[model samples]
Target chain A: MLRHAIALLSGGLFGSGLFISGMTDTAKVQGWLDVFGDWDPTLAFVMGGAMIPMALAWWMRSKRVTALTGEPLPPAPSKEIDTKLIVGSVLFGIGWGLAGLCPGPSIAALSYGGPGLYVFVAAMVTGMAIAPFVRARLDRAVPAE
Target chain B: MPIDWIWGLIGGLLIGTGGAVYLLGNGKIMGASGIIGGLVDGSGLNTKWERILFLLGVAVMPVVLYPLYRDVDTHITDNYWVLIAAGLLVGIGTRIANGCTSGHGVCGMSRLSVRGIVATCCYILAGGLGVILFRHILGVI
Candidate 1:
């Protein structure tokens, strides 16, 4: 029960923050990406701002094996920077730059974004649904990592 | 509009607090893409209720919060096909990379994960390039 509540609260806080910060504003995101065009630096500030507390959390995490709730923290992240990771990030960046809607803002902004958001989100979910099959095929074609 | 650094920082602190909640309470990263992506890819059923509640928390906020900033412009492009392509790409790419902005950029980078740093660099560069190609050269919005 506590865990669930925490997750819910976390999501709520995350959504509220994004909305409050105006990260849901697609124009602002696009502007930040628009280095050649008239650019906006608000997104950079948002990231920098987020980094402060998160870095502190990580510092706390570094010394501990279990989370505050007594659950074991997940293993250390993988160090590999393979082709799949690069290719995937590149693809994601293109889409993000194209639309200026990432998963967080898109999800959080759904209540106010009108009908088109549903279409975008549905297509995104479909792509996610198909990912396991795609991964399986790739695994067969590519050697072990 | 000009940069709004103060709000940006305040909002970011809130976001980080949410992340801290997830890390400390749930022992998980608070990444939107990863949370939902796990469910879609069929690996998150074990925590289905948690994910659902989290999404509900996210999906329900605008009702209460939208009034605060009626002037902000959320310029989701009017072009539908572009929206479709963008959505599909975001889904696949985040899954493939094992993270998106939240997972890699904010959460992972905070932990000093190399993968997160590399992925952030890749996506930021790619995003910048995309803006140049699509917005400048091709004149697409």
Candidate 2:
């Protein structure tokens, strides 16, 4: 019960922050990505500000195995920097540059009520649904994760 | 800096605090893509309710706050083709990478994970390149 409650609160906070910070603003996100065009550095400040508290959280995490609530912490992240990581990141970046809306903002902004929003989200979800099959094929070809 | 920067910072702090709460309470990374992606892929049925509730919270909170932030507009392109293409790429890429801005950029990097750092660098550079190519050269986006 506590865990579920925490998730709700955290998720709500995350969504609220995205709106308050203007991250859901596609124009601002695109402007930040537009380095050659008139660049907006606001995202940098946002990213930096977000990292500060997260960094502290990580420090707290390092000192404990389980969460303060006694649940096991998430498994440690993998260290591999393989082809999949590079390829995926690049693809994601391209899409992000093009659209300026990521998974969080995409979902969070749904209330804005636009046909294009649904179209983009539907397409994104479709891509996710097909990814496993694509990965399977790629793995068969590469044979080495 | 514009007033937007201040709001960005304030909002960022709230986001970080949200992440912190999740980590300390649920003991999981608050990754938007991974949470929803796991559900769609059927790999996260064990935590189906958790994911749903989290997503619900994420989806509903903005609506609750909408009246207060009525000026918050996305300004996304109306081009259906572009939206489709970009959406597809984002979905596939984040899943394949196993993270997105939240997972890799915020949580993972804070933990000093090498994979997270590398992925962040790759995506940022690629995003910049993409902007140049699509917006400047091709004038598509």
Q: How well is each residue in A1-145 modelled by candidate 2, as lDDT tens digits?
A: 7778888898898888888888888888889989889899878877787788888988888788999679898877888887778888888999999999889888888877488889989988998998888778767777784
- Stretches off by above 4 angstroms in model 1 are none
TM-score of chain A of each: 0.93, 0.93
In the order shown, the candidates' DockQ scores are 0.80, 0.81
Could you give the C-alpha RMSD of every candidate to the true structure, in order shown?
1.3, 1.4
Q: How accurate is candidate 1 locally (lDDT)?
A: 0.86
For model 2, residues B1-141, the per-residue Cα lDDT tens digits are: 358889889988988888898898888998888998999899988998888888888888889988877477688899999999999999999998888999899898888899999999988998899889999999998
Error of 2 at B49 (Å): 1.2
TM-score of predicted chain B, candidate 1: 0.95
| Model 1 chain B weakest 10-residue run by lDDT | B66-75
TM-score of chain B of each: 0.95, 0.96
CAPRI category for model 2: high
Question: Which residue pairs show backbone clashes in model 1?
Answer: none
Candidate 2 off by > 4 Å:
none
Q: Kindly list the per-residue Cα lDDT of model 1 for residues A14-94, writing each as its tens digit.
A: 888888888888888889999899898988888988888888888888788888678888788899877778888999999
